[model samples]
Target: MTADQSVTEPVAATGAATMVDVAIVGGGLAGSLAAAVLARAGHRVTLIDKRAVYPDEFRVEKIGGPQLEMFRKLGFIRGLESVACPYDRVLNIREGKLVDVSVGQAYGLPYADLVAMARGQIPDASSLIVDEVTAISCSDDVQQLELASGRRLKARLVVLATGMAGALGYKLGIKRRVLAAGHSVSFGFTIARRDGAPFDFNALTCYGERTADGVDYLSLFPVQAGMRANLFMFRDPADPVMRDLRRDTEATLLRLLPGLRPYLGDFHVTDRVQNWVMDLSVVEGHLQDGVVLIGDAFQTNCPAAGTGVARLLVDVERLCTEYAPRWLMTEGMGKAKISEFYSDRDKIAADQQSLKMAHFRQALTSRNDIGWDVRRRLHFLRRSLTHRVDQMRPGWLAQVRSALRA
Candidate 1:
């Protein structure tokens, strides 16, 4: 689940009720962090998640750049350090030729550490409820929930951090559209000798049309020689590329990197793979009169940036600071203010994602075709020409152009 896209289905009547300051739905990175932030502010928080613990092994292996800054500010730096794969380079490869490296300052850390750090920033784990929310209702002063066991919680405010498919967003009657841009995929993981993998510790690799059949993709974060680094590559189930990943991931990888095939020193799979649907669209507005959507609820960026956790924490950082605990408890910021904040943050994220995707789309659509054709060599040259994107790069304007086209 990338955002608070889940909803509580309407349930049978129940009478029990408990009061809380904030009700947090979903237990993923965003929901958990929101629980911590609000708890630190002294708000009584009741978190309801379907699961009792974090998924033991995750496919999202690293966090870098602005997200690292957000982690440090939120006090997750040590947690991130404990399980991190530090990397500074991000390599871009089209067909077999090198294209460009996205030059950005900042380091990458492990996903588990970032999640733990954010969760640790809050008061305690005992406060949250590890159960399902069957129904929810909101009004001027109170927001309510009904547990599957018939218990109810009424809070002063409800924060929806459920990722895509979480119940509350659907209940809120927010506008939503199913995204078709990317397919669901899993990352294969294992550690290699420092010399075994020749990847730069600071760089991530980007492949234009990662599959000869056509699929947009990027590989990120290289851990130290002894530590585990993730390999994220997948084909849309509906696309022709699915036959390769589902049947033979290893064989597919070998085909992709012929030079690195001999370097697999005792490499083997260790855990069940983790995967999720990738939605590359934004929900129009994330605020309604009685509820406010945060993180993936508003918009989900492409995995190419690999900044899902960073973007979620960015939401927490802004909301916890701007609204202030004292203000939310009193008169409430109302629907208008909440919607404005969601829109502002959504624009920043969407604009950044828009820029990266534009370059990615062009690179993906033609890299392989042109790489094989010397006469039609325009595709490979086009990618190399516009290699990086940042506030300093001219590509920012290119992004603006694409958004208008969209």
Candidate 2:
């Protein structure tokens, strides 16, 4: 466990109500990380969740880029390194030809492990309670919660990180306005060669050949089990091809992307097929008294765009480190104070960028107009050309670009 330095002393919810400075109502990534951050800062924090441990969910299994930087800043990079499978290179291809190569640090692990890692960082493990928050009564000064186990909790403020489970938020007049329902479909499972040898590439990404297929891309990366694959598509959930992909994964994948056959080299799925139909949504009327929302609880992201972690990190950083602490110093937790987080420049930018990337990926994969066709070609061509130039010049181009910016 990455959080071995921290203790795991469970806080039992007893007969009477417990009081804390802050109470977070979700034990997932955002809530857990917030609890750890606040508790480490010597705040009286309580984190409540229905499940004691996060299940092996097929969601956001990889973390990299600015997400890694945020984890480092929040003091979770060591823990992440302890549990994640690290890889630094990804070979990008299209139509069986090389497009480019991406070089950066990334980690692959199950979503459950990531949550556990974050939860373990709480300085006082007893601050975490395993229970469901049935109802909440919010005010400017104090927030009260009713638990399913018949216990109560009172706090100065509340953090709603319940994710796509919006029933609790709905009760508080917080509603999710769906931007796109069934926006995309994603499949996750492990794969290994039939002969049991390792794959040649460290990581690989294969883009769709034609727009009609609605196949965005197939990403193969390393995980603890083996090579993990995440296939993203913009097709309808009820499409028969979805069944084919689930039942005859390898064959159907080859049929849709014949170019992938040579790279795969007689591979077979090593685990049960897990998939999700994503919806692009944002919570409206969330700026309420005594509470604020973060992560998927605020807005959901397109898995194909790979912006979920980035947005959530911005939320956690702004809320826990900046807004929450500052607000706690003052008197009340009214909508006037909570609205600052929603209007933060960085948080708003991240949210908008996630939506923009969602549309861009969908159009890049499925748009059949002449403009997009030309764009798709130019996109791959530009990347390929840049990769070639970088391969020849090594760090020279980067240095020149940096100097130019200066």
Predicted structure with the largest TM-score when compared to the true one = 2
Model 2, total clashes: 0
Q: How far is candidate 2 from the true structure (C-alpha RMSD, Å)?
A: 3.7
In model 1, what lDDT does residue 348 have? Answer: 72
Residue 39, model 2, lDDT:
91
Predicted structure 2: lDDT: 0.91
**Which pairs clash in model 2?**
none
Q: Runs in model 1 with CA error above 4 Å? A: 1-16, 57-59, 88-113, 179-186, 191-235, 262-267, 284-286, 324-326, 345-406
What TM-score goes with each of the models?
0.73, 0.96
By summed lDDT, which 10 consecutive residues of candidate 1 come out lowest?
1-10
Cα lDDT of model 1 by residue, 1-406, tens digit: 2212243343345555778777888767787777887787777887777665565545356666677787778666766676665555565665555676666644444454545556666687776676677677867667778776556788777777776754557666666665546633445444344345543335546353444444444364455424353444444546544455445655665565543333343344333434444656556545555566677776665554465665677777776656536447567546755665565665477446654664455345334555544523565576576554443586785688799999
lDDT of 2 at 85: 100
Candidate 2 lDDT over residue span 45-107, tens digit each: 999887777888999899998889999998999999999999999999888888999999999
By lDDT, the best candidate is 2
